[model samples]
Target: MKANIQYAILIAWGILSVSCKKDNYKAPSGAFSGRLVYQGQPVNVSYNDVYFELWEPGWGKSTPIVVNVSQDGSFSALLFDASYKLVIPAAQGPFRSLTDKTTNSDTILLQLSGNLTRDIEVLPYYMIRQTKFTATGRKVTATFAAEQIIKDAAAKDIERVSLYICKTQFVDGRNSVATKDMSGAAITDPAGISLQVDVPALVPEQKTVFARVGLKIAGVEDMIYSPVQEVAL
Candidate 1:
């Protein structure tokens, strides 16, 4: 009788241990949320399809989170606990595909644990302008102006905008010229409204010049280049 009682007590102990282990283990099944913005405005208003992806260190499978932006540019989505990379494709039209080009895509990294809400903003990559130079016997003056969007006003200051005259070549309507940093040669005014590049001795001729304008922001990539502007020199 004594031996039988001891055996029963050992069995109960083993079962309790297994039950406690099972109760303590939990699986990942929570969600995360976030907002996407460009410059200062929301992105969903302009982009119809946005791609969101999440990756984990040892997880075998990758999870994809998709969201549709509303007219006001707000968005919400559910995600798991992992590292994520997000991208929004360019819309349709002349300006639609500007951000879709291989060089213009925006990428953001996020780490989600349990549930979270994050805000992200993307800035424009380049500024483009059209300029013309008129020469009257040794005097040359040029006027340049372009439209730009400030994705992140806090990240960029409009007062320090600079324009660069890039020597470029085009292939199939795409800039083929190897772009360089020419901001030192560009011009900026006190008001930061527009840039006027003056070529004192440049002769009267039709030449193509590329302009890039941007600002330097902390914790962000180099000043975003404006879309390549084609100017006649």
Candidate 2:
């Protein structure tokens, strides 16, 4: 009778220990995934070692989540149940064009539930300046200006304005050049209009030189034109 009792107690202890171990273990939650594409092409973007943030509407707060974007433009993240306004820092990533002032907004929206994958597309509007090029005695110069009429929605001219220029080139039927700070290289008029330019010495042979003039405003695309004027040496 004593031996039987001891055997029963040992069996009970083993069962309890196994039950406790099973109860304490937990499984990982689901993950979210997506790809970033532009014009039907995958973009190789760099991320700044930071996780993207998702903001809840009207909550005035956000949550940080880890994100991994592969070289092929695919991305993955772990998230919980929530509707989020996603935002990545403009300083990093292949979505540099998304940071262009012409773009309406840099933030994207996402809904996460369980393990899922999605594809995201982002288009960027580039602000370009209008230009007219002229050549004289082996000296080539391009002049750029804006054509958009500056007026408020009430059709009244605004007193103050900011304008800038960008050097542009067409690449494989797409605008590939990035807009740079041309403030020092620009010629500003008294009314605060700006122009694009190219020095004579820098002009290459038979190359189509273009300039883009951009107006400063949120959601405003660049106005671009090229009027080539040639002169004989």
Superposed by TM-score, candidate 1 places the C-alpha of residue 17 at a distance from the truth, in angstroms, of 21
* Alpha-carbon TM-score of each model against the true structure: 0.32, 0.35
Model 2, range 1-233, lDDT digits (tens) per residue? 99999999999999999999999865546577766656654443322232355566766655555465553456776666567666765534423335434335877776666776766665322112344445444333444443333343523221222222222332111332323334322435523344323323333443443432233323332221222122232
What lDDT is obtained when candidate 2 is compared to the true structure?
0.43
Q: Which ten residues in a row have the lowest lDDT in candidate 2?
A: 157-166
What's the TM for model 1? 0.32
> Model 2 — TM-score against the truth?
0.35
Q: Per-residue CA lDDT of candidate 1, range 79-129, in tens?
A: 556776555544311112224343345555567777777655554422333
Backbone clash total, candidate 1: 10
In model 2, pairs of residues that clash are 45-94, 46-93, 127-222, 128-212, 128-213, 128-222, 128-223, 129-212, 129-213
Best by TM-score: 2
Alpha-carbon RMSD, candidate 1: 15.6
Provide the RMSD of all predictions against the true structure, rounded to 1 decimal: 15.6, 13.0
